[model samples]
Target: MDDARQPGRAYRGRRRAQAAHTRYAAVLTTAVVGAGIVALGVSTALPEPRNDLSLEASGNFDDVSVRGGTDRAGRSRTSNPMSNMPAPDVWILPMQRYTLTSFYGERWGRLHPGVDLGAPQGTPFTAVAAGKVILCGWNGGYGNNVMIDHGDGIVTVYGHASKLLCKEGQLVKAGDRIALTGNTGHSFGAHLHFEVREHDKPIEPLAFMRKHGVDIQKHTEAIYG
Candidate 1:
C-alpha cells in the first residue's frame, strides 16, 4: 500500500490547488457585482434644477426603466426640459391709457381672481397673444367676456368689458383689440378684468409680466439688486 511513488499524497496536493482557485473565483465574482451596483447609483443620482431662469424640468431622459435605475446600456434616464416649458410672448398693452387698479388674488368681498387695468369707457382692448376665442359672449359675473384659449393649456380672459369684438371659435393674434374697457358687471370703476390661466386655474398676471422681462417694482431696485 505504501508503494507507487506515494500517489495518495500527490492526489491530495492537486485537490488543494483546485480548491484555492475556486475560492479566488468566488471572491472575484463578488467584487465585480459590487462595483456594478456602485456605478448604477452614481448614474441615477443626478439632481433637478428649479428656477424661473432655468427650464421647468431637468435631465435628458426616457421612459423610466425601473423608476430609479438605468437602462440596460447603463445610461441614466432623464426627461426633456423643453417639454414642460410653456410658450411665452410679449406683453402688449391693450389700451393706450390704462392703470392696474386691482391685481390678481386681491381680496374684495371674497377673492378677486384677476387684475383690473383701468381705462376710460369704450377704450379698445387687445389680445395678449395668438389664440382661439373659446367664450365670446356674456359670462355670469363677467359682462361681455372674451376668453382666448392660447395653445399649450394657456388661456387669457378679458372680463368686464363694454363691447365684444371676437366671436366664439375665432382665432386672434397678439395685439388684436378684443374688447373695450368698461364699468360693467362686478366692476369697481371703468377697468378691464384681465386673467391669465394655466390648465383653467388662475395665476398672477405679474408672473407673465416678469416672464416678458418687466419688473413689477421700480427699475432701480430690480436693476441694482
Candidate 2:
C-alpha cells in the first residue's frame, strides 16, 4: 500500500511542475508580443528628417507688410537663388534692383559713412547676413534705422526706413526682410542708407561685399538668372 501511494504522489508532483512551466511560457510570450507592439508604435510616431540649411519664410515677415515670392518676370524670389555663389557666410543683396545714389566718403563738410541706395518709398530691403538686431528705432540722423550685429565685430546698418520690420534683440538671417526704403531723418529722398562697420567704424561697403564674393553693383537684379 505504501509503495502504491508513493507512485501516485510522484505523478501528482509532476503534474504540478508541468502546470507552472505552462504558465511561465504564456507570460513570456505575452511579454514579447507587447514589446514588439510598443516598438512598432514608436517607429510609426517618429517624424521624417528635414534639411536644416534649406531656406524658408519666417513668421516674422508675415507679421509685417513686405514684398516677396515671385517677381514681375515670374522669377522665384524666396528660394536660395544664390546658393551656388561662394561666400564666407550666406549673404544677399538688400534689394533686387536699386540705384546707388551716394557712396561712402566726404559729403559737403562732414563724413558720409554709408551708401545711399535709391528705390521706391515702400520697397523692401533684406539683411545681408545672419545676425542679431542691436539697434532698431529712430537713431537721430539715421531715422527709423535698424542695425544688425553680425559676429566678429561686424555690424550692418539700414537707415532711413519708412517702416521697420524688425525689433531690438531679434535674430535675422540673410535675405530676411528688415525694413522698407523711405526718406526719413536726414535723408533727402526715398532710399536705403546701407553701412558696414567694423568695431563701430564704417568701411567701404561695396569693396567689403565684393571681397566676400558678392558684387553689389553687378548682382543688383535677381540672385539667379
Candidate 3:
C-alpha cells in the first residue's frame, strides 16, 4: 500500500512542476511582446529630421525677399517665411526735422566732406540704409561719429552725435534710430553731419538722395512745418 501511495505522490509532484513551467513561459512571452510594442511606439513617435538650408542661404539676418534664388543646397528661397518678406527701402533721411545749415564741399578753405543738418539738441536721428556699423565713437573733427558699411563699396557716415545708440558691428535697417543731434567735435551747434561715400570718396548727398526717392529738403519741410 505504501509503494502504491508513493507512485501517486510522484505523479502529483510531476504535475505541479509542469504547471509552474507553463506559467513561467507565459510570463516570458508576455514580457517580450510588451517590450516589442514599446519599441515600435517610440520609433513611430520620433520626429523627422529638420533641414536648415533655408536659413543658411538667406545670408543676412534681416528679412530677405524671395525672388527666385537658389542656395548651394538647391533649396528655394521661398521655402521659409524669413526668406519671403519684401526688401527694405534703399535709403531714408537721417533726421525727420532739421535745417540745412551747411552744404557738402569747401568750408573755411577745407573740404567738409558732408552736409550739416541743424536740429534741436538731443534730437534723434536714423540710419540712411541697412548695413553694418563699421565705426562708432569719437573721431578728431566728427566727434561722436558712427559709420555704416552697406554692401557694394557704399558707406554712410553720421557725425557730431550728442549720443550714440549703436555700436560697431551692429546691423541696422533703414530709418533705424542711431544717434542724437549734438554740438560735439567741430560742430557750431546741435547738428548731424551726414555723408555718403563710394569707395571712400564723398559724393553729393542731396543729388544722391534725390535719386533714391528721398528729398532731404522736402522731408525736413514736411516734418518741421
Position 169, candidate 2: lDDT: 54
Comparison by lDDT, 2 against 3, better one: 2
Pull out the clashing pairs in model 2.
none
- Order of candidates by TM-score, top first? 2, 3, 1
TM-score of each: 0.55, 0.59, 0.59
lDDT of 2 by residue, 1-225 (tens): 011111222222112212323423533443344322110000001012222211111121221112221241132122223223222255556765578888887666445777888887888888886666656777656678887766556778798889998986566666667888888877788888888877655688998887764666765312221
Q: Residues 1-225, candidate 1: write the lDDT tens digits.
A: 111111222222112222323423533443344322111111222123222211101111121123334452143124322223332333334443467676665363344556777777878777765556656666545666777765555667787778887886565655566877776665667778877766555677777756743333221111112
Error (Å) of candidate 3 at residue 57 is 40
Please, what's the RMSD in Å of model 1? 31.7
Q: Which stretches of model 1 miss by more than 4 angstroms?
A: 1-90, 214-225
lDDT of 3 by residue, 63-114 (tens): 1112112241133112322232332334556755578987877655556667
